[model samples]
Target: MLVSLTREKFEQIIPLIATGAQYAYYWGKWQDLLNRLLISVVAVVVILILDVVLGQGAQALILLLGVIAGLYWLWSPIYWASLRNNQYRRFPYSGFWRGRILEIFLTEDLIGEEETVNQRGDLVINEIRERRINLVIGDETGFEIELQAPLQRLYKAIAPGQIAELLVLSRQPNLAKIDKFTDAYIPSLNLWIGEYPYLQRDVFAEVSRQLGSDRSRANLNKNRVRKPPMK
Candidate 1:
C-alpha cells in the first residue's frame, strides 16, 4: 500500500502548511501550560522585588525573561513548519502505507511527575497519569506496530478491522525500510492520532479517499477473475 508522491502532488500540500503550523501554535506543548504559568508568576514576583532594590541589573534580566518566554511559546509552530518543508526536501520520494486496526483500548499512562508533600509533610515526586488511546495495527506484510495517542472523541470510536494509515519515514525511494514513523491517520474517523501535528488533514483526506476508491476498483477487478480449479 505504498503510493508514490510526485512533486506536483506534493505542491498541493503547500497551501495547507499554515493549517498545521497554526494547530501547532495553539496546542503545542499544551501539557506544559500549567508549569509555564507557575514559572512566569514566580519570575514576575522575583523581578519586581529585584527591580525595586537593584534597578539597572534587574531591568536587563527582566528583558531576557521576556525573550525566553516568547521563544518557549513560539518554538513549536516555527520548528514544525520548518521541519515539514525539510522533510519534503530530504525525502524527495514518498509512499503511503496503511494497516488494519487489530485492537483498540484505553490505558492510563504516566505523563509526568510533580513534587508534592504527603499528609506527613514529606517531599516526594508524585506521578501524573492520564488516559490515552492505545492501538495495535498490522499491515498486509504482518508487521505490527503499537501506537498511543491522547484520549479524544476522535479516537474513541476506533474499532477492530478499520484501516490505520501511517506516515513513515525512510531514505529509500521505495520505502524499502520503514525504520521510523510519525503518526497514524484513521480515514474512517477522519482523524489523526499522534503526539505531533504532522499532516495537512485536507490533503491527507483527499489522497486517502482517492486511494481507497482505487483499491476498491482493483479488488473488484481481481474478484472478477475467477481462479481455476486446483488439479
Candidate 2:
C-alpha cells in the first residue's frame, strides 16, 4: 500500500539526529585502530608476495616495505592518540571508545513533563517518565548522543555543573532547565530540554478533521512555509 502521510504524521516520527562531532566521538576510536592495523597487515602481506615473485630483490623490497610499514605503525597510534586527547579536552563529559574513560552521562535527575522552545522554531516537550540519562554535547543544538553499550570505566573528570553549562550555550530560544533530575544507571549528568516539537497526529487528528478541512489546511499551512528563491 502506498501510504500518504499528513504533515502532522510526518512530524511525529522526526527521529532525533546527532551532531557530527558527537558521532565521531562515539565511533571513531575502534574504527581508527582497526583501519591502521589492517593497513599495516596488508602492507606486510604484499611485501611477502613481492619477495616470492622477485626472488633476487625480494629481501631488499621487503626491507623497504618494512621500513614504510614500521613508520606507519609508529605514527598511526601517536596520531590517533593526539586526536582523541584533543576531543576529550573539548568534550570531557562525552563518551569515547579507545581510552579507559568509559561513559559520560549528559542528562540526569528529572521527573514529570518538561518543555522548551528550540532553535529551529520547534517546541520540545520531554515527559520524564523515569530517571533516564542521555549523553549530549555542550551546544545550542541540544543534540543528544548515544554511546556504545557495555560501558566499562567511568570518568570522574568533569563535574556535573560543567556539563550543564555546555548544554545551555545561550539564554535565548526559550531553553528550559530542569534540575534535580537523576538517572539511576548513570547518575552524573543533568536533564535539560533544548527543543522538542509536538504534532497533532496523535489525538488531535480526528478532532481537527471534525472541525473541517479548512481548519486542517490552516493547521498544516501554519507549520509550512514557501521556500525562498535560490537566485
Candidate 3:
C-alpha cells in the first residue's frame, strides 16, 4: 500500500527531511572543500619549487597563502558538522513511507575534473560527469512530491513506475529520503516481483515463505496479493 501524509502530517515531517537534506548539502560542501584544499596544496608546492629554481623571493608570499588555505580547510568541516548537529537535535525521530515513482529524468551538466595524486605520486585524471535529476513521486493518497537530486546512488537505483520506500525524519515533510525500492505485485504473472533486480531473490523467498504459512496460505490462495517485504 502507498503510505502518505496529510498537510498536517507533512508539516510535522518536513523538519526531519530537511535535516537529512541539510547534512547531504554540507557533505557535498565538505567534498568540495577537500578538493580545493588538495588543489591549493599542489599549487603551494609548485610555487615553492618555482621560488627555489627561479629565486623569485616570493617564498614568503606563497607560504602565507598555503597556511591560510590549510586553516580554512581544517575549519570548514568542523563548522558544518557543528551546524548539522545543532539542527538534528531538534528532529530526533525517524520514519519511513512508501511511494510510487511517477516520473524520472536527468539533465546533464559539465563539471570541472580535478587532478589528484595517487599513493604512488602519479597524477590521476578524473573526469566529472555531473547530472541533475528530477523525480516525481506519488503516495497512495495521490499526494505527489517533486524532488531534485544529484545523480547519485539512490537516484540511479530507481526508475519511473517503481514502488519505493523512503526514510524521513519524523515530523519533517520536506526530508523524504529514498530508502529502497519495494517488490510489487504483477497482476499478469499472479506473483510478486521486485522493483530492483538485486532484490528479486530475497523478495521471492519472503513471499513464498509467507504463502507457505497455514494462516497466510489461505489468504494467498484466495486473493494471491502480496505486500512489500520489510527490510
Q: Give the candidate number with the greatest lDDT.
A: 1
Name the best candidate (by TM-score): 1
Q: How do all models score by TM-score? A: 0.67, 0.25, 0.36
Ranking by TM-score: 1, 3, 2
Residue by residue across 72-170, what tens digits does model 1's lDDT show? Answer: 544545545655656554555566678899998889999989999999999999899999988899978887889887788756578999888866656
Local error of candidate 1 at 1, Å?
1.7
In model 1, the clashing pairs are none
- What lDDT does model 3 reach? 0.51
Worst ten in a row by lDDT for model 2: 91-100
For candidate 3, which ten residues in a row score worst on lDDT? 192-201
Report residue 159 deviation for candidate 3 (angstroms): 1.6
Please, what is the whole-model Cα lDDT of each candidate in the order they appear? 0.70, 0.39, 0.51
Q: After superposition, how far is residue 193 of candidate 2 from its true place, in Å?
A: 21
TM for candidate 3 is: 0.36
Candidates 2 and 3 compared: the better one by lDDT is 3
